[model samples]
Target: MGAATTRATRGRRGLPWLVVGLWVVLLAVAAPFAARLGDVQRDRATDYLPASADSTQVAELQDRLPGGETTELVLVYHRADGLTAADRATAAGQVAAVAHRHTLTGTPRGVPSADGTTLVYPVGSNEPGTDEKKRDAFVADVRRLAHGEGGLTVRAGGPAALATDASGVYASLGGPLLYTTVGVVAVLLVLIYRSPLLWLVPLTVAGLSDFLARAAAYGLNQAFGTTVSGQSAGIMTILVFGAGTDYALLLVARYREELRRHELPHDAMRAALRGCGPAVLASSGTVAAGLLCLLAADLNSSRGMGPLGTVGVLCALAAMLTLLPALLVLLGRRVFWPLVPAHGSTPVARRSLFAAMGSSAGRRPLTVLATGAALLGALALGTLSLPGTLKQLDTFVDRPDSVTAMETVAAAYPERSAQPIEVLTPAARADAALTAVRDTRGVADARRGRTGGGWTEITVTASAPPQSAAETATIEALRHRLPGSHVGGPSAQQLDLRDTDARDRTVVVPLVLLSVLLILAALLRSLVAPLVLVAAVVAVWGAALGLGGLVFGPLFGFHGTDPGLALLSFVFLVALGVDYGIFLMHRMREESLRGSEPAEAALTALRTTGGVIASAGLVLAATFAVLTNMGLVPLVELGFVIAAGVLLDTFLVRTYLVTSASVALGRRVWWPGRLSRAPSAAPRRVPEPVA
Candidate 1:
């Protein structure tokens, strides 16, 4: 039946082939347009925060309060001997001259460090609304002034400087990262398949996935006003490469297996699809759904990444099911060139090591279960002490202009350079709220203004930098002090992050688990199996997190643990982990239906499916581990955690969890439906050895 289906598919492959080509062309047409959507905002951190009272009430409150653009150009003067008073005066004069000439806003105030090694000139923007281009012009003018009358080695470092630096870093890193990912995946394919033709299949499929993903993103952005930034682009690349290749491998491996069954080439392709397609689709669907959960995230960047990653995975699935099979039919028999076919032989019995491991695991399920649990528990201890910092300056390897400017501003005018905190008060109580915030701990100063009718805005400067835990705590405390007034700013953004992290920890895990359990139940048609599978997955997930915390927290200097990592780890472990469980359990059920005793069926299933599981796990683990090469700590931690989680799920969880559950349940494993008990009249031939 499978053979006939494949042959029929081959006869009608032209339509799918055309569809694949059309997708390719569409993607190509959209590529350039997609590439131009860059992060257009300066101070993206500020943008990520909720609208502050000052910004919301700017029009009505403009006249009564100090300008919102309180910050002027920050000046840094340095010499080998440290800045002298004369150098400070000279730098201040230069800053004042530039500010006066440009008629920049706010009084030009000179601030020098206590050590006298740094000085800052705050030249405020001229009007309430200075466009970015005008600010850029002002920055350029300041640079020229600071560098005039002999090379004083003065450099512009502030919000403007940081924006310039971050842009350069993005430009330098973006193209190279994309090229390197492609190059690495290409080289790996060549090494693994050893056939240029076969290698190109995965590369082509990956490219197609990328194109579709981008087009989908463009469509989504156009409709929803959501944009994908350069940072998210890297994530899209990885999702396509790792997931697309994994799906391709499943199809190719199954195709080879069917070929060994003496099936005709076209028939074998269809047979492979029939056997593997369901699993691949299930895996991709779970992953895409898991990623899509990021839409609930408060951060726009994170929320965008969720859909972008999902679209990529979905495209990869489409390519695997439609495009890849068609391509395989076109390249029939030549897919595994230079390797002679091994005819009429089941490859399973010939592998002594795998047979031994399977037999041992099947026999001593308790020992295997206990050992795996212990290993995972040890690793999970690390997660308890995970840090939660997301400061860019702390994370980036090289100081970008923004970070340098921040450091300079910190050194020169610690009090004045503080990020603004906006407090909103009811018009009736505006004066009281402003006075309360001004006296709050860590607040350097505060000023208030009534916008109109029922609201007032108070701008407060903190003694501490925004986004710090201390700053967040201070903001929360101030909010409490004001009673009814709302506090929002960079500090509020931090508060939001803290709240999001808490919600993810408490909510996302349970939701993901429930989703995975529901998926397993539907796939297996057995509540008992899904329950055990989800439990085992949770164990593996905890262990992976605990282990990652130990490795990343204590050994590495990265104190800020990425909040997104936990959610990502949970999704991968549950979704991908369940895949292996399904493969093994499905074979076990088939064996049982053929009249083998539960124990024998379990052994047979393990011997047959264990090798494929291990191989797939290694490929996936390696693919995820490659993310470390991106030189980003978050990526590195994500790579390590995900790879470790998958490894645990594959080796420990699948082997012990599924096998033990099968043993313990025996006939009851298929309870409520008794689906595993379907009898076959024909004698089962010691399970024709796995190839």
Candidate 2:
């Protein structure tokens, strides 16, 4: 018997190393692919658009045209007071030089402002084709050569130049975003554990998970033709660290408790996994399900993000559950250092902060619930203050050269659109399409361009500035009049993005709600409990967006909101906010299963799980908040709202409102489940908890 016990101990000791060895092989396999994820990333506006949109069709047709899509740019030479002959001569000389170097569609033509302050040359090139790198190079060269002498300001602006700047911003996100997120998670872990060695384990595991997630994302792009954008990949990275760290925190907390009761570290790890595994799995499932619901969206960007985001969550979960546990057990309880939990040792007796909060909630459940609901309702009203959909010029937080150039052009050409509106019509009906474009009310000029692949391209300039209501009206009229033609351009693409986002919201929101509701019901086996959770998350989302409205314009100085904010924020807040909900409610239910009455179970669950939830919530919110420091307005807005929402949901909704509601509902909170019928058995004596 002694020999057999020795052998069993040896086997237990060897298991963790085997787990680590397996992960080493998996990591080796994933590393190469992960390095190549950025190579496949596509950041073009057309890449994000639905194939059915008119603008998307025009873009596709242009790619098949005579020169494989045109690279258009506008060179602006302006003097504040007025232009002199030397300035005009300088502009003309620079335009000629540009034409000499690049294969332009026609002779360089300069349009002078009525005030004689600006000389603008519309430059078009087809030599670079639709290759992003080649086009960026071409735009870069033009900017390099087109310099102003003396007081004249020379700037480059147009679709190609704008795209180059946007791509540059996107390309720069991967490194800084990763570094900031890692720093944030590491600090939170250090503070949460207060053990130098202990904080390293989960952070290392999460990094591996993020690397694995990138590899999976690359594979998805290769196999499924998934559109991997810089934004999507950045978002995937955020999920891997944020959600991954969350699971690690919960598991470590449980493992520390088990370390006190069990002698062997391996035994303690196994017991901890069993104790918290269900809640963690259910929490991850809720997030994965909500993300997958985005597959129903018509917007390609949103649809493709669904699978990639899920891959991130699942990878993080896989690493934390397997790799994280193995490493923790292998390191032994000594890894916890000063705060190590010794076998048979009692934890320091102290009241949990959550206990006090839970007590207040239990004493006046209805009043607490009502007050929370009212507060959330009031916050929701702030959405009315949100600015209109963000425009291209206002998209970036830091001013890009193209944005500055465009702003100058908008001021110079106030009465005429600087950007041409492209219309693709059947080659056989070219004349009719041309006629319709010319007859459009807001069109200042209409001209026929290249014809190929059964389509004819017509370039039309709006009498009003680009993206103005007058210009939009003209495009709409052209679309109505020329049914067979596709009206498109930069402005048209923005319009399509807005309309598609609106449509996506109506479809995806309901599906996400249903998916979350169904998953919660399966996990809890209770109708009322699932509804309560779903309602809580929805309220949280509304309040978060309302908070955005209150600050985005007045506080942040943003001119407009990102069109996708409503849907994206809704999905994230509901899914991630429910992550804490699962942690709290699952614990509450566990207490009920142990024969505690609903009210007692609610308070007990909060008192126990609340600290871990708070830690996890803070880590997740901080990781997202790093985006606020990003260069783009959209990233900042998204980060601020999500981070704020997580904090609110963590301290307010999950701790106070949810606990009070559960206390008020009692056993009926588990309606139709066996617990609703009666306590499983006589009330079991509760144990002293580390939390």
Task: Return the top candidate by lDDT.
Answer: 2
Q: What is the clash count of model 2?
A: 0
Worst 10 residues of 1 by lDDT: 50-59
How do the residues 1-691 of candidate 1 rate in per-residue lDDT, one tens digit apiece?
9999878766665655676677668778878756654433222343332233322233223334444333234556655446766676688778777767776655667666676666666455644233444555666667778752333447676445544444444454456665676776777677766776787887787777776777677777777865465556566766777778878877776787887775456667768888878878777877776677666655555667778788878877887777787777677777678653455656544754556766777777777767777777777777787776666445454554446656766665666434567676788887778778877888888887435446676778788775666677677788678776667644465466546655655665676677776776777677887787778888888887887777776776675776667776776667667767877777777777778777677777777777667766766676677666655566777777878888888777776667866775776777666655655354365643443
Worst 10 residues of 2 by lDDT: 679-688
Total clashes for model 1: 13
- Alpha carbon lDDT of each predicted model: 0.66, 0.91
* Superposition error at 548 for model 2 (Å): 0.3
